[model samples]
Target: MTVLSQLVSLVFGGLVPGFLLGLLAFRVKSRWCPRCGESTLAMPPTERDR
Candidate 1:
């Protein structure tokens, strides 16, 4: 029973959070345009800037 408890704690406390953070990082990185290496959500340049 003690070993089972420790295994559960290790999985839930460490692995779950680590997996979630990695997934979030991957999602955020995917938002960038690969060719230009710019964020896909970046605003278009206005006439004033041209």
Candidate 2:
């Protein structure tokens, strides 16, 4: 009983969270462009002095 309980804790508590976090990481994209290394589209262009 004790060994089974420990195994369940390791799988449900530790492994489950880690696997979920990995899955989440794949779905979410950061604000920056990875290829060009540019700031996200939200960034504004610089203004020139007249």
Instruction: Specify the poorest-scoring 10-residue window by lDDT in model 1.
Output: 36-45
Using Cα atoms with residue i matched to residue i, what is each candidate's TM-score against the true structure?
Answer: 0.64, 0.45
lDDT of 2: 0.77
Backbone clash count, each prediction separately: 0, 0
Which runs in model 2 stand beyond 4 Å of their true positions? Answer: 20-29
lDDT at position 5, candidate 2: 96
- Per-residue lDDT value at 35 in model 2: 94
Please provide, for model 2 over 1-50, each residue's C-alpha lDDT reduced to its tens digit, 9 standing for 90 to 100.
Answer: 99999999877898888998988886565656789877665745567632
Per-residue error (Å), model 2, residue 38 = 1.2
